[model samples]
Target: MYLGVLALTAFVLTVFLLVYLGLFLGRLPFLQLDRTGVVLLGAIALVATEVVPLSGIGEVVHLPTLALLFAFMVISAQLRLGGFYDWVVVWLDRRALAPPVLLGAVIAVAAALSAVFSNDIVCLAMAPVLAQLCRARGYAPLPHLLALACAANLGSALTLIGNPQNMLIGEVLRLDFGDYLRVAALPVLLGLLSTWVIIAGLSRGHWLEASASLLPSALGRAGEVGVPLDRWQTFKGLTVAALLCAAFLWAHWPRDLLALAGAGLLLTSRRLHSRQMLGLVDWQLLVLFVGLFIVNHAMQQTGLPAQAVAVLADEGLDLQEPAPLFAASVLLSNLVSNVPAVMLLLPVAQAPVDGPLLALSSTLAGNLLLISSIANLIVVQAAARQGVVIDWRAHARVGLPVTLVSLVIAAAALLPWRA
Candidate 1:
């Protein structure tokens, strides 16, 4: 037993190190690894090393969580096919709103869309539109783009479908969608308000100068002009998505099957290349969830999770309670990114309402670092394409304070309820 424990501990430590190295370094012998790739590789390493018995893997693989994530991905994909996000961005950009007013509108729209679709996808779809609009209106895209990223992350906490991690946490905790929203709604509102204030402050005097007339040189060719609206297709996608959301809240439908069917129905398109839809699917994220599921499961088999909980308890920090767990979650989430950290901690904790706290803490915590969330990175990368760069220093200027403020609000709102 002692030998087995020793081997498992060593294996888990090695797996984590490899994952971090892959994330930080980007290349392994045969793999150009992203976060997902690194996690999956770590799972493979654990299995190859015999650190976790094959049977033990079952304990960590949460089928319900995966089902929820897969369903939301399909729904998000359907919306993408309908060009729903692009339509919204185009509409918003066409308005003659002032810069600060426009920034506020941007925050509201980004938050709303992210509450339904994947936040990362929302950022990717809107970033270019925002950048082009900013250049056209003679506004700097940097601050606005950063606002979009921060707002999207904040908004994702509003609904289970907003982000994959929330989906996983909600399903695993069997949280009622309506109830969870009620619990998280206040903090989310506060977070959004905080996002607007922090970003507006960062932009400072520049917000006044943000709307100069577009330079002649700033004029550029527009993006892949989308087709005249296929209203039927768009309606069909929206109907299916709305029904699914209602079903998830009210009915007992197998969400995965329903979502997959919905996605399949939308594929009846001769105009849009199947490749276009296929390319948009975030397969790496799915793979990352699966891999982390396996690795986190293997690591749990070592008894470390329970042991850690006991140690925390001895130190007057019980994760089964809300306050300490919330605090710990924020720290770990920023340390290793939320998804993986959630995977690490979820096993040992026990609280029915922990889901909301976990979801809120992890998602909001992404505001702490430039590299903290894929959604943040997506905004940064998209802005770079338009010659608007947001480096670590630029991001931290807003992210650090925003994270601190939001976490405090969320904790105050949740900790009392737990008591």
Candidate 2:
């Protein structure tokens, strides 16, 4: 039994290492593995090694994560169709505020939108809009691009539905939406403030006193504002989304059922192409969640998690308790990117601490590395298309310090909830 556990541990570790390498290195000699592909490959490795049986895999797969993820994707899908995200960015850009005030407004708006939608989508939709707006207004796009990325991450902490992992943590932990909000609201508030200050400081040194032509050379440069909204399709998506959110908050509906129903409603569209809705589904993210569930589930069944918990306890670090878990969460979140790191630690985290700590650490840690969060990458990629350069050095200038400040703020806020 011990030998089996050890071998399983080795297998899981090896799979994780390979996945990390693949993400960092990108395409291991034509294997061409991105993050999701790496996770799927890891699952295959576990199964092929005979270390995790099929039944054992079932025990570890987390349904709550998938359900909540699906729900938010549906909601975000609908919002995108509604032209909501695009409209919000335009409103911010058109405001005739001072540069500092404009910066604050941008961060505030980005944060609020990200609270209810996928921050990744929010950034993808808004970054180009923001870049062009800055160029048009004679301001550097870098500051706004950084603000969009950072604020999107910070804002995602506002609600249980903010990011994919928060939804998972909230659903699996059976946290009340209201209750989760009450708990997380403080840190999110503090985090956003810190983001603004940090961003402002970073911007002062970089903001150039020159205006660039706002005239979009290409239609794509005009951002989502210039795109024609399919009003009927937008209405269909929003109605389904609104009803689902109402069900989640008021009826306490089983999230999966509500989301699946919502997604079904959208599928019934007569005007919109089914392919377009399907394209917006974020299938890769879903696959990443499923793959991590299988791999982590296998690890738990092998008794490795139990042994590790015992060993940590012996070292005076019980993850079942809050503080150590919070510390562990921050460390691992930066190391492996929050979502997969959370999956590895989830089995050991018990209750309140698990929900809040996982949410806090994972979300805050995204500010640490350029590759730490998909939201960051989305913003970076979107900005790149607009000729706005934000390399690792530029990102780390803001990301590293913002991560530290946010984590510290979260630690203080979390002390009351730790067991």
lDDT of 1: 0.77
Q: Write the per-residue lDDT of candidate 2 for residues 180-241, one digit (tens) a residue.
A: 77778898888889888988887885565354433322223343354445566666766776
Positional deviation of 276 in candidate 1, in angstroms? 3.1
| lDDT digits (tens) for residues 298-352 of candidate 1 | 6666677789789989999888788888888888777778887777667655776
Residue pairs whose backbone atoms clash in candidate 1: none
lDDT agreement with native, every candidate:
0.77, 0.77
Q: What is the TM-score of each candidate against the true structure?
A: 0.89, 0.89
For candidate 2, what's the RMSD? Answer: 3.2
Q: What lDDT score goes with residue 200 in model 1?
A: 82
